[model samples]
Target: MTAPVFVVEGAVPGDGAYVLDGPEGRHAVSVKRLRAGEAVVLTDGLGAWCDGVVTGSEGKDRLLLDVGPARVEDEEQPRITVVQALPKGDRGELAVETMTETGVDAIVPWAASRCITQWRGERGLKALGKWRATAREAGKQSRRVRFPVVADAASTKEVAKLLAAADFAAVLHEDRDAPSGALASAELPTSGEIVLVVGPEGGVSPEELAVFEEAGALPFRLGRSVLRTSTAGTAAVALLLGRTGRWG
Candidate 1:
C-alpha cells in the first residue's frame, strides 16, 4: 500500500527536513500509531509534496521527519467543479466527501430556491467549515496532491455567473422535455473548467433552470432513474471524468 498522506500548512519540497506536529501529528502518532522510520508523504495540497520517513518523536503531538527530494505535480486537465445544492442535515457534508474523493477539483454549495435547508449567519458559517473539513480529510485519505476547494454558498445568480464563466457547464435535471441528454455524451474540452450543477432535494425550479440554461449551462440527465440530491453530483462527476479521459 502507498504511504499514508498528510497535509502540512506550507511545504518547501526540496528541503531536507520537515516537521509534522499539532493535530495531524497527534493523529499520526496516537491514532495511526506511526512508529519511527515509517515512510510517509506530506503535501501542501497544491501539487507539492515530499516523501519522508519519521526520524523521531519530539513530543506526543510532534514528529521530526527526514525528507527526500521534493516534486511538484501538474494539475489534471478539464478541471471539474461541482455546484451542489444544500441537502438536509449532514447530507451536504456527505456530498462534499464523496465528490472530493471522486476527483472533483472544486465544490460550490448552492442554496436553491426549492432547497429545504437554509443557511444563514452562524449556521451557514459552521456548515461551510464542515464542508471544508470534510474535503480536506477526504483528500488526505485519497492521497491527492491537490485537494478540492470548498467554495462558499452560492445563490442562484452567483451560480449563473459561475456557469457563464466555465468552459463547459451542465445542469442536472430529470425533465423529459428539458432538452436532456446523457451526461456521458457531452463533449468536454481538453483543458479548462467544467462545471456541473446539482439541484436540491426538491429539485430545480423552472425559473432557475431557465437562468442556468441561458447562462450556457446545458441541462443533462445521468440516466433513466433519478438519484438523490446527495449523490447526483458525485455520479455526474464520474461521468465527466470518464468522458474527459481523466479516469483512463
Candidate 2:
C-alpha cells in the first residue's frame, strides 16, 4: 500500500526542510508510525507536492521533513463549486466529505427555506472549519495535491449573490420541466468557474428556485428519482468531474 499522505503549508522545492505540525503531525508520527528517513509526500494543496524524507520527530507534537524538488500537476479544469443546502443532522457533513473526495473545487453551505439546520454565530465558523478539515483529510486520502475550500454558511439570497459572480452556474432541481438533464447537457464554460446549487431534504422553495433562475442558474435534473441531500451533491460532483475530464 502507498504511504499515507499529509498536508503542509508553504512547502516548496529547495526549502530543504519543514515541520509537520498540528493534528497532521500527530497522524504522521503517532498514527502512521513513520520513522526517520522514510519517504513521504507533502502538498501545499495548490497543485504542488514534494517528496520528502522525515528527519526525525520533534517531541510528540511535530515531525521534521526534509523537502526536495517540487512536482506540479496540471491545473484543474474550470473550477466546480457546490452550493449544498444544509441537511439535518450529520448529512451535511457527509456531503462535504464525499464532495471533497470527488474533486469539487469548493463547497458552500446553503440555508434554504426547507433547510432544517441553522448556522448561528461561532457555530457557523465551527461547522465550516470542520468541513474544511474533512476536505483536507479526504484530499490527502485521495492523493490530491489541491484541497477543496469550504465556504461560510449563506442564506438563499446570499448564495444567489455568490452564484451571480460565477462564470457558470446551475441549480439541481427535480422539476420535470427543467431545461437540462444532468450537468452534461448544459454547455459548461471552457475556461471559467462553475457553481452547482443543491437543495435540502424538504427541497428548495419556489421562491428560492426563482432567485436562482433569475440569477441565470439553469435548473437541471440528475435523474428521475429524487436523491437525498447527502447523495445528490456527491453524485453531481462525480458527474461534473467526469464531464470535465478530471476523473483520472
Candidate 3:
C-alpha cells in the first residue's frame, strides 16, 4: 500500500532524524492511529518531500520519525492555472479541493459580475482561508509534494491582467454564438502557463467576456452540457491535462 501523506511545516534536508508535532502530528498519532515503525510521507507542500518511518510518539500531537531520501520535484510544464469564479456556499471549497487533486498549479478566485455570493470584510478573509485549507488537505490526500497556490480573490480587471500574462488562456463559456471553437480545438502549449477562466453559476457578463477577450482569453464551450460553477473548473483543468499529456 502507498504510505499515507502528511503536511509538515518543513522537512530536514538529506537523510536524518526528525520530530513531527503540532496539529498534523496529532492527527497522525491519535486520529490516524499511526504507531511506531509505520511508513509515511512528509511534505512541505512546496516540492520538498521525504519518506519516513515512525520511531515513536511523544505525547499528544508528536511523532518521531527517521527520514531519508529527500526529493524536490520541479513544477510541471505548461503549468495549468484556473481562474475560478466564486461559487455559492461550500461549493467554493469543493472547487478548490478537486482542482488541487487534478494537479493545477494555482487557483484564482474570480469575483465575476454575476456571482450570487459576495465576499466582504472578515467574511472574505475567512472564505479565502477556507479555500487555502481545502487545497492543502486535498494536496496531501493526492500525495502531492507541491500543493496548488490559492491566489487572492480577483476582480474582472485583475483576471484580465492574468490572462494577458499567460502563454495561453481560455474562458469556459457555453455561448452558442461564441466565435471561438471548442476548448479541445485550441492548441495546448507544452511550456509556460495556461490559464482557464471559469465563470459563476449565473455566468460571465458581456462586459467581463469582452475584457477577457481583449486580454487574449478565448471563449470555448466544454461540451453540449452545461456544468455548475463548482464542477466547471475541474473539468476544464482535466481536459487541458489530457490534451497536454499530463494524464499519461
Q: Whole-model lDDT, candidate 2? A: 0.82
Model 1 — which ten-residue stretch has the worst lDDT? Answer: 175-184
**Candidate order by decreasing lDDT:** 3, 1, 2
**Local distance difference test, each candidate:** 0.88, 0.82, 0.89
* lDDT: worst 10-residue window of model 3: 173-182
lDDT of 3 by residue, 133-234 (tens): 999999989989899999999989899999999999989886646544378778878999999999998888889999999999988888878899999889
Cα lDDT tens digits for candidate 2, 82-169: 9998888878778988888888889988888888888788987787778888888888988888888887887888888878988988
- lDDT string for model 1 (1-248, tens) is 88999888875455577778989889888788888889999888888888989888766788788898888989899999999999999999899889988999999999999999989999999999999999999999998988998988989999999999999998888773544446777788999999899998788899999999899998887888889999999988888888889999
In terms of TM-score, how similar is model 2 to the real structure?
A: 0.88
Q: Is candidate 1 or candidate 2 better by TM-score?
A: 1
Candidate 1 residue-wise lDDT at 140: 94
Clashing pairs counted in every model: 0, 0, 0
List the candidate numbers ranked by TM-score, top first.
Answer: 3, 1, 2
What stretches of model 1 exceed 4 Å from their correct place? 176-181
